[model samples]
Target: MSKQKKLRKADAATIRRVLALIAPYRLSVAATLVLAAVTVISTLYAPVLTGQGVDLIVGPGDVDFAALITLGVQLLVTILITVTAQWVMNLVNNRITFQVVRDIRVKAFEHMQVLPLSYMDAHRPGDAISRITTDVEQFSDGLLMGFTQLFTGVLTILGTLGIMLVIEWRIALIVVLLTPLSIFVARFIAEHTYSMFKVQSETRAEMTSLVEELVGNEHLVRAFGYESRAEERFEKINLDLQRCGIRAVFYSSISNPATRFVNSLVYAAVGVIGAFLAIGGSITVGGLYAFLNYANQYTKPFNDISSVMTELQNALACAQRVFDLIDEDPIRPDAPDAKVLPHGAGKVEFDHVKFRYVPDVPLIEDMCLKAEPGQRIALVGPTGCGKTTLVNLLMRFYEINGGSLRVDGQPIDTVTRDSLRANFGMVLQETWLKAGTIAENIAYGKPDATREEIIAAAKQARAHSFICRMPNGYDTVISEDGGNISQGQKQLLCIARVMLRRPPILILDEATSSIDTRTEILVQSAFEELMKGRTSFIVAHRLSTIKNADCILVMKAGNIIERGTHEELLARGGFYAQLYQSQFARS
Candidate 1:
């Protein structure tokens, strides 16, 4: 299809989707339309009343003073009703616009929860945030403008035309024939500006992403002396946005004046035709005056609509982005008869698993492992050797291409994901703590945990001493990401969270890497207590920490190169020994 045809098709689809979203508020929409009709009809009747008053005042003292006074009162009542109805209509429009925006934002966020991790890895978080927040705000503005102006404009035009035709059909026909000129000009300019607006929206999203990235990593930027480079990068995107914005605004701005010029011609035609008719005595002077007023009213809507076309174009563009996010493919759902994972001895088995992120580029191929009940399995590997990938697959964060993973002899996929995940507790190298009290952070996995239970878990994770040192102890509030605490303290809080869960299986991926050597010794002892009789998988680089593990698996390039006890691996003098010696040699 041609580009113009495609844009028109997309615009139609966007309108349909927006209408679908607004379907629940049909009653309010109907009320707004009724109010608009009342407002327009009242506004049109005022001009008719003025014309009658003029007719009553004929040739100085020949005027009917009583009739003029009555008409003036009627005009005043009509104006008041018009103002009141318009005010109510605006309130309804605001409610609908903001409600629609809220629904869209909420729906977008809900969809994000189900979206695949790969989707998140492939897109910038700031861009997603912009679509939900910034883009939705833009859509609300456009929707409000359309509801406020477009509805009234259309009703006014139609009402004025009907009134004009009743007084004088000839003038009405002249106005009708000339009015299409305004529409044609508006359509031509609006079509050209739509693509520019789309470009501008996309550029704005890119700018948002860049700013978020730079600001979030401000410390790193300055520490690495990257301020100048960062500024240059930001300036480049800023310039692109400026150029796109200017072109869009400039093109859209042409629509208003071009349509206004056409409307002016229609008004001029009605005036000249009405004058001749009144002079020829085919119409009363008062009737001719009302027709001229109706003619101006008929053309005024076109100007109002043309002026709002720019906002509508930009709104539709942003709406499309939001809808695109809502329509992203979510993670695959579980089977119809998926069962909840039952609590049992943790026996995890990976049977000939094969997986890769990019097609045809193998990362973990033909991998097989089995962890028996109450065993501590340690995984040691160089970077990019599929260590963390194993943890992700175990947690079902990503599906393996060819695999049958089982937990306690039941296929992992046979159980609901939430149920399967509840069987394991995880603590990672990167710690995360939401803004809350230290006790709350510790009891995150178990919200109903008591204060005593929270304190006990903290003690088990070797974090209780530091927790007591805080100003309010367990009651003290911390910021998100634990900005007020040390990195070691944050890691301890994360460990305490897992301790509180006490799941059947545990996955510790460099869980103690952030702590100091002294604290590491204490936390490691606590981990030993936590791991008793529970299946644990440890991914670590420091070989000393795993010296007493039940089994150690040395990995290289997605395959296990060695599996044995620490003494057995060292006696063999293989890759494991070299890796172990390399770390100690550095010390």
Candidate 2:
């Protein structure tokens, strides 16, 4: 696997694409923004009232009762309005954020379905899960909170600044100049912190993969005495993840306190300047007091804006990772103009087909073979000699690198994958069963199969006798991957599934290799019945298994070296004859 690269800062195009996902909720977002603005306006009024109340109490005459009461009531009303607006904004933000996260997760999973098998083979399952869970959660929390605080902070700053300038421009000028310095400091910190977040995400994904691997293969780990090694590997990943997380937190942690310190200095400067202006008789005492209050209010928004700026950068890093996955091109299937395979008569022809899993290592080279309807063709080869590769090509798991293969005289490439695969039945060496009842596993290939049909298929595979002997018979619940059953039984269940499908073409890849000799005899008899009217491709390591095949093809080093009926090949004394003699001679 290739090493994952660090996440780059998102560009304008990527940001625009992320924003497009929320376009459908524009009206709700607008309402939330309006509420945020109203709340900011109401909050700004509280500090102004404090100044008014101070002036009212300090008036030359006896305390102005009417003025005091009026100011107090206005402050109370503004506080109530501010609280109500905040409540509404929170409700709206939560609703919108949840919906956005839901849509992102659903789309990611749906896209996985259309991706090519090669893409999945290259990525770890746990890493993919981390993207959907941890990364998305981070995005939702940071984006929703940052957007709300940002809008409110800007509105609050504008309202406070306008009031401050009206009372005294000099004090406001000091605040305006000092605010940019704080923003500059925040931007610098965020730039450095963003890199740390990217590292943290990758390290976390690695840790998740390690845990998944250990859990999925616990039995093998214990059998191989790998507990200590697994723990050591996990500890290394954990330490790396911790280091990355610490760096990210440390960089972001500086922003809040730094902003507060800068705001404190600006507030002091406003107080000193306001006192000088009042002494000079350029402003009334009441106006100077109000200007001082508005100065503090102005700096408060700057502090909030600076804090959110740091958080937004982290979210942008995560969004970059998410959008990168979403933007990958899904594999294209056959086009609408592609020809549909006619109802196949079970004839299969490989016309000079060639294939390679990687660029330089060819698995099949200039291979050609033909099987008439109902013919049983056996493919015999040493390990990695391309027997399984042939079956994979016939199923179109990977497209041919060169030449053509046809079924019933039609080129396989022209047919839709679904249409071609629908007519084939396969039994792999390793049987995989989901966590369900025995009946359900057998009926997996044909979900609409009747109960009687399922029972018949199981009987035909010679699995019905053992299945009936189980406590619950066909209703017996299998564990995931059929872990509760023996390896041979799992293979039998898979055979039963393929029998249920009853397709015109059958491919068996080491299908009976797991069973005992006696059980193999029973399965072989049932398989003969299944292959009676269908073209079949059988791959077996044991020569005894394929001795009765209509024709046997011997393969070596990606090329067919010999082909003949069993007796003819034995009499010819070629590679097949030698392999058979060596194997059976030992037994």
Candidate 3:
């Protein structure tokens, strides 16, 4: 964990790439562009009409009342037309924006399914969520407000400049000279604002991760008396978030005021130059008035252009984050020609396998194991000796660093992930149930399970009695992670879930380790029934629970030291025997 790499700003190529998402709505985009052009033309007409009104009112001849009324009506008509065109443009722009956001959100989520478990293990849940929600919303605003405004503002600026030249070329030249300076200043502000916004997005994501972790593990914090420590950590992250927010707003707020100041300078220059030209008889007084009106109109589009530039930079920062996630290569699956496991008397073999969660520190090394259908294999090892790691590999949660694992004489890697996982049922030390009825939680794996089948599975796991005793019986709603239930009951519900699945291969990773002695006896009996005809791998520290396993493996460090039946291993007077004596003998 060196500081997570900062995302690059949205460059020209990135903007073009994002715009391509709207390709399917080309018709709507074309309509918007057409309306924008019409709106710009209509907006220019008002200045010309104002100039006509000025000349008529300040007469060198008779004052024409009819001409004044005509100019006034034409100006009113232009305003009405410009407003209508803008309304149409807004509709089209919002439609494209919402559609693109929907597409990107879907693509991001769908791509996540193919990514390996390792990627998820390395990233926080809140960071991933921010990419989907906050990042996508920013993209929407960019598409809608940024894209629409930038396009229309550029067209308006060009159209207004052309009209200004036609009215009085000297004034137009002054405006043109000022254009380059305004653009340069706008670009400078945009660059600074973009950088700050990117930092702010990252800090916000970090803050979200902290909050999600605290809320998800509130029970652990309370149990460990860590509330004060948690609060301190939260305050630190919150302060950092506040600082980033202030910096981003400070940079963004500078663009508008600076653009307005430049526009004011251009307007004052226009008034002075126009007055001189009018007095010198180089231009008509009416022409000078129209030129001034056009100058004011011209500055508006430039102001809008600068604003859109800032928004585009912010949007690009958001898009960069989302694209980074979408570009991650998902774990490669088996080739098309890979072998498929054949139906048989289920057998699992691990040959010379080696693994490490971290490089250079092996958790399991040169390990080999075999179990035929209906065999119960118990793995007995100290806390750090990799019992759960072995089970994880068997379930394909991680790929092995070396060696081979096969099921039914076919390499595990050759089988499709879906097919491989469909053959196993697992129960962990800590059981998890969703916020649903007890029946729904039990029938999760088999969603189409009937009431009779649900009841049967519950009965098999010895959970039916307690479930029946509840107020709602089988329909009792289990709160988040089954919070309404006791630890033993939750384990029983998990047992029922796996039993309902009824896979050929079963794995119990310290499944009985958390239950009381009485509940353990009940669960052990139910487990005995479940293991009758499956190839079962059980990891347990409690020796009594695994005494009847067909093969008992005693492991230390990263290697297995002894392998025998309970009686044979006890008679050998080895580590297994010593561990057994220390526990069962004392009892």
Candidate 4:
């Protein structure tokens, strides 16, 4: 939680941006403010009534019972009206604040969908979650508290000062001069606390990320005997949070006491000044008493407002985090007149393509490939030799740096991304199964898929039999990353999801890695059936599986070194031949 030093930026702009979020609820906000004004006015008049009641009993023998009874009723009525007004204000304020937060959270989630993978790679998932949830919650709470403080603080300070000035401008000058002291004290403390509170917020998000990572892979941590190491890391973070949290709280806590001390001085000076004015024949006894009451009331808003400035700083910091998230660079947008791709023969051709995650370290350069409709293309290479990189280019996950790609003779960049991606179905080595019933997960790609179609796809994936054995069968929920089932079972569910899609182009990258050999045979048979009458790209290390491929691509060091059928490459005695021989030797 160490502080990151930065120059304070302009807050007027940030405040305006936050106020814009509240603009939509102006009607409710206006109504709330009206009620708040009534509450403040009622509260400010109570002190004057007390002065009148005290004046009615000027001396021990000069008491006025009739006037005292009437003043007492007036005081009680004012209190009841203030309470009612405040109650209504709370309801409207809560409604407006909650609605604004709901919109902000929804906007964040929607923006998430359009952001590029590069952005996500740069930030932690838990940090993003904290911004949308915890940060928004903090902002909402701070705003609600600040609402009442804003109305009451301003009105009380101004109203009390006006009354004091009307009674005696000499004492009013002293109160005015002393009031700025409380503001200066508040400003100095708030500035220091701002940095500390900001650090605490960042540290909290980091802690949340660490916890999510550790919990998500608890089995991995235990398997590698890394529990003790994880605990050590968490303890370090926890201690940092404690140090930062204490400093931030301590700094903000002093503002109230420091301002109160200044307020007490103002009170003493006013009391002494009012006594002289009372004795000088310039003010009545009742006027002197009321002036003292107004002086105290004037300073109370100063203290309350200082405390609220602390809340305001926190709210601004949290809001900046959310705005930063919403401000991330989004994915490359479609062409202005981008059109939906027309269904055609799936002929994919890569022409002098170039790509690399890093600018200088080229991973794929001057690559070329051409596949006909219904052809089974297999890409075989050692890990990190650009097999996945090539597939990533085809799916448009990473845009090629230099050259263009075409599908059915149309440049892919000329069409909309949704249309291009909708034409392709993918199943990766890493399986993804969201939380839902088995049927729902399977029908993810094809939302309108029928029950019979789902069962058919599950049967082809060799998952139907096991699914029926579960207590709820296809209706069983796959909770928490599908941890309730076996990894192989999860992989099968992913395959079933893709099978239900039945798109024109298929990309299977190590699609059968986790399955046992017996299950692999069944899954391969299913893939053979699914690949018929479709253009397919297969990335596999198991050379045996690609023996019957229409064409095999042998790649190394970002270039295709060999290309042929299995028997043809074996006869050539090249890289692919050596790779096949090494596998056979090991077996």
Question: What is the full ranking by lDDT, best candidate first?
Answer: 1, 4, 3, 2
| TM-score between candidate 1 and the true structure | 0.97
Report every candidate's CA lDDT.
0.91, 0.85, 0.86, 0.88
Candidate 3 weakest lDDT stretch, 10 residues: 1-10
Tens digit of lDDT per residue, candidate 2, span 229-340? 9999999999999898998998888988888899899989988888888889987677777777777778887677766766776666676677767777786778778877
Clashing pairs in 2: none
Cα-based lDDT at residue 510, candidate 4: 89
Q: What is the C-alpha RMSD of each candidate to the true structure, in Å?
A: 1.5, 3.5, 3.1, 2.5
List TM-scores for all candidates, in order: 0.97, 0.90, 0.92, 0.95
lDDT of 4 at 327: 85
lDDT string for model 4 (5-45, tens) is 24255345567888999999999988987897898889878
Model 4 worst lDDT window (10 residues): 1-10
Q: Tens digits of per-residue lDDT for model 3 on 1-587? A: 22222323236657777878778889988898898898889988877888888888785677898988888888898999999999988888888889889999999999888888888989999998898999889878866777578778888788889998887888899999997777887888887777777777788788888888989889899999999999999899889888988887887778888888999999999999999999999888888888888888888777887788788777887887888899898887777877555445679999999898889776787999899888999999889888887887887888988999988887788887777887889999978989999999999899999999999999998889999999999998889898888988999999999999888889998898778888788888989998888899989888888889999888898788999999999999999999988886864
C-alpha lDDT of candidate 3 relative to the true structure: 0.86
Identify the candidate with maximal lDDT. Answer: 1
Task: In angstroms, give how far residue 294 of model 1 lies from its true place.
Answer: 1.6
lDDT of 1 by residue, 1-587 (tens): 99899999999999999999999999999999999999999999988998887788747878998998899899999999999999999999999999999999999999999999999999998889889989999899999999999999999998998888888888889888988888888888778877888888888889899999998778899999999999999999999999999999888888878887888898788778888998899888788778778877888889889877778888999999999999999999999999999777999999999889999887888888999999999999899998999999999999989978999999888999998899999999999999999988998889999998999999999999999999999999999889899999999999999999899999999999999999999999999999999999999999989999999999988988899989999999999999999988775
Whichever of 2 and 3 has more TM-score, that candidate is 3
